[model samples]
Target: MALTATGMGSGLDITNIVKVLVDAEKTPKEAMFNKTEDSIKAKVSAMGTLKSALSTFQDAVKKLQTGDALNQRKISVSSDSFLSATADKTAQAGSYGIKVEQLAVNHKIAGTNVTDPTLPVGEGSLAFDINGESFSVDIAATDSLAAIAKKVNEASDNVGVTATVITSDAGSRLVFSSNKTGEDNQINLTATDTSGTGLTDMFGTGNTTTLQDAKNAVLYIDNQKVTSQTNEVKNAITGVTLNLTDADVAKTTTVKIEQDNDAVKTNVQAFVDAYNSLVTAIDKMSSYDKDKKTAAALQGDSMIRSIESQLRSVASGRITAADGSSIALYDIGIKTDRYGKMSIDDTKLTKALSEEMPNIEALFSTPGQGLANRFYDLADSYVKSRGLIADRETSYTNQQNRLDDQREAFSLKMDQLTARLTKQFNAMDLVVGQLNQQSSGLVDRLNSLPGAVKKS
Candidate 1:
């Protein structure tokens, strides 16, 4: 009456039975898939950590791969009040007595002042020549002193010249200035007028005052004279550039250049530190924990082994130059312990840097076989695009995708099984219900028979 046959089916708890059967099939497979996923994800994370360490180590290696960074120089100036100096790698390490004999200035010229700055000069043009470069400003018959200055200042083809009007109590004057310095850059200008030479009367270069002269900077290094077009003098010393600020034949400043040892040591230590950090990362990834009864994700992995082997091989490398200059990290006091960590002997390192810097440079920065060079290449192979670590991550991700696909397929199978079991139980329940109905009717009819009650 309550449709229990379709649902409970003679109180057999069919719903729970079907659920238990489905769970029994799903739980183990689900747990296995989850375990596999966890393992793959852990491996991917470990690869990430290793990649990070490798990247940092590569940065330090890049700093040492070039001889420029390692062969840097520091300068000492006795006095910067008068001058300053800069040097490059080719500059020899020594002291030089510098004397600032002269300083250079830009050329400037000004025409005679006019009583009325608003009066037009004439219909004409003015041509200017600085060094070999030439430009011209057309003067209109109605253009005044201020107007002429503006035109010259705004000329599209004007070469490095500035025109300004300075008004004093006596009168207003127009001035022309340019960066026409050095003896080669002579400054000259001329005016042509179509009406009664009025343009030449107001702004003639022949009568203009030489406000400033074009002169070269002169300096002396160790009693040797040097000259330059501008204040910045070059090649007075090989690989050195001197900046002259003020002239004083009597004031002498001393410039000294030497190897930047502290900076070099700092860089070397950075490389060592980065290498040790990467080693630590590798160790963690490959370690097995006895207490936890667990192993690291990358434990016993071939890629890890290959990377460690490469590091050891690179660490033990050596190079020898043509001038009997031979070096290894060992000669620079970098020692390897049993655990493959590097340590420095301070005294030995100091001595090596002081005496064998050239050999050290050759060891770490000499193009193909240097320590930094080889290490950088190795690191690139592991961490670059589609490289070792990236390939592993990609593979792990693909595995995850496949596992998800398998899970989806399993889910569909379980759904089908659940539906089939439900259908079969419902059919069997319908048949049992029909048989019970017939039996009850037969027993009732027997009980109602004429002698059946008397027997009861």
Candidate 2:
């Protein structure tokens, strides 16, 4: 007694047939929606991969290119003292002490005025004017003379100042002296009340006096001033060279600090590889296939378009050279077609890199600046654009949610339809049973007296 619109048998019910047909259509729609969701998910994953690759490529490029595009720079170190850059590469110029023997050493002598043995004059104070900076310190009386001396030695920023304790038949007194032997090296030392209550009791204060007088020594490197007692000059080179001599007077010598070639080669190779990898990715994204559609995720993506455009613009931009002519990507052999896939014109690139490298570098990176400063900003912007990969992921996520909601709603509706069909089918089953009973009764009444053959 199944009800259906199109009956396979006479007993088929119409309502059941309609419900079955509708549910059948819903099943495929749900599957199709699921397939679409999966597709979107795949696209999101691909976008993330691409974005990650771009970020890595940008970092690599920045590392390789950031610097004075010039591979080598020569630094000269000279000292007035008899010192020179060691011929042996294993030696460090800093290890050699120039004019150290003549340098005045500060000696400490503990005053008899130490009223407290626990607070013995170990903690002392010394103030000195160094290169316009006022340096002041208070030492604990309990601190050993050696400990106090260590503190003074550690304070190298002060002008040629050093400290030590002198033990003699007279007793012990802390002495502050200038290591440099010169009028310029003369230092004015004044012990404060907090340092010890006995300044006039031990060392005279009130007048400008040399704490300890030693012949001021002079040192020159490559005719440049090297050292003085109160002299402010430390290294002739701005942190680039060191004076390695022991003489107190001026001496002429040379020290060579050369560019690290190995580092330069490593950076260059890294740049080439990163650029090539990025180019390969771009090629894959833009190329077409005979059996498949263009990478749909990249299709109509503004980020990809912008990246390609900027990269092309950078590649084509001109760089002004010292000779006044302009430099281009073509000059460097980094040529790209309208699609933006790149190939190294090896010979051209080599010639430009070797012969007119300054121009090539200026085009990609500004002179005297890191490589990133030149073209990395664009690459950075392209890679870090808003609503690019994140937007794609968000869109996919939204669609997935929407589809899931729809599927849930559809399932509920289908369940309701099935429930209604089941109820109607049950009702029809009872009706069929009643119809059979009525037909049986009519046949029984007709056959009561006369013989009747029933159609089976």
Candidate 3:
């Protein structure tokens, strides 16, 4: 009935020590569960890499969707042929008369020692008038034309001008032009210092020429002067895609670039893939087996449930169409089945996309109003929601601390008990020694008494 007993053969059992040690092993399992919970929690903890400002990209595409609303428009093509673009929509069906013009770059005066226009010449520079703005830059005699070119490039702030040098069979001549639009955007160049030892009179003619004769070309759209430039003009506002076939005076030609359907399709696919990746992750984590009674750690998380609902809601949302036909993502061929997987009916979607585009746009692209827009917003919000994962992680931390304390206490108790048990066993050893001494004395006395009796 002792509260405790200790020794090598004491009646008390050491099974509690064994049982507790076994229980301690459960920590690893708990740790794994905690880690999984943290992972699930982390799904909401950090903001996802965003879909690259979907609105901005969508707006850019939307602009393409509308052909410029001008009867006649002119656009200048870039000298660098590497860049190319197409309209998002074709011009309204019409007998569109198109023309392309090519201009030979005028290299009137080449600065001496300025082999490449990019290299600069000392105390030598070109002057030009752009939109009534007067500008003069003094190029040092030794400065390579390249150095002078850098200064011109940086003068975007002062002269409202930019300069480019076009190479021709004749040689390189400084080509300075107005960066602005309208009739005022003309360049008048005069050699400021063509007299230095470094300066050479390359312009056999005086410092003057028609701006059109220079690389700049004047373009008229539908008999309207849309642009007059010392170089090609980019009339982005008009949306006119100009292909310059020749820059000579009265040049006649046609330039055409069609709508870029492939780009739009690629963008759509990217969005679908991103969204599906998120869905797939959620589906795997939320899977459950009723018979087995097993559920994933994130199965009942509110955030997960909310995310699923928002996605479905967006996919099912409706919008009005141009032809008064009602439209929805489903109508446009985005299908979501019971298993929470999404697949697009490409044929149906594409037909709706190209033919009834306004309807498709209405379905998912209202700035802050459409279903797709709202759904993305919801996803953004839900991904930030707080919940159980964080709570459990905290609990695990607290439990680990408590376990450490409990183990320490138990170790101290075991040590004390061991010491007491050893002391008790050592005392018993002294008692056994005393008993041996007494027994030996008794044996000797009995042996002596027997011998005396025999002699009698």
- After aligning candidate 2 to the native by TM-score, how far in Å is the CA of 296 from where it should be? 6.5
lDDT of 1 by residue, 1-456 (tens): 434555543556777888999999999999998999999999999999999989999998998887766666888899987788888777889999999888877788888888888887788998888878989988888988889889988889988778888899969888888765676665688988877787787667566888888788888899998888888888789888888888998999999999887877887888889999999999999999999989999999999999999999999988875476668899999999999999988788889878877787888898899999999999999999979889888899999999999999999999999999988887777777767778899999988888765543
lDDT values, one for every candidate? 0.86, 0.56, 0.51
TM-scores, one per candidate:
0.86, 0.63, 0.56
What is candidate 3's local distance difference test score? 0.51
Worst 10 residues of 3 by lDDT: 66-75
Best candidate, TM-score-wise? 1
Off by over 4 Å in 3: 1-85, 89-95, 102-129, 133-212, 215-240, 245-276, 289-293, 320-326, 345-351, 382-456
Error of 3 at 359 (Å): 1.9
Candidate 1 regions with alpha-carbon error over 4 angstroms: 1-6, 111-159, 162-176, 179-181, 185-204, 322-324, 454-456
Residue 107 deviation, candidate 1, in Å?
2.3
Clash total of candidate 3: 27
Best by lDDT: 1
Candidate 2 minimal-lDDT segment of 10 residues: 86-95
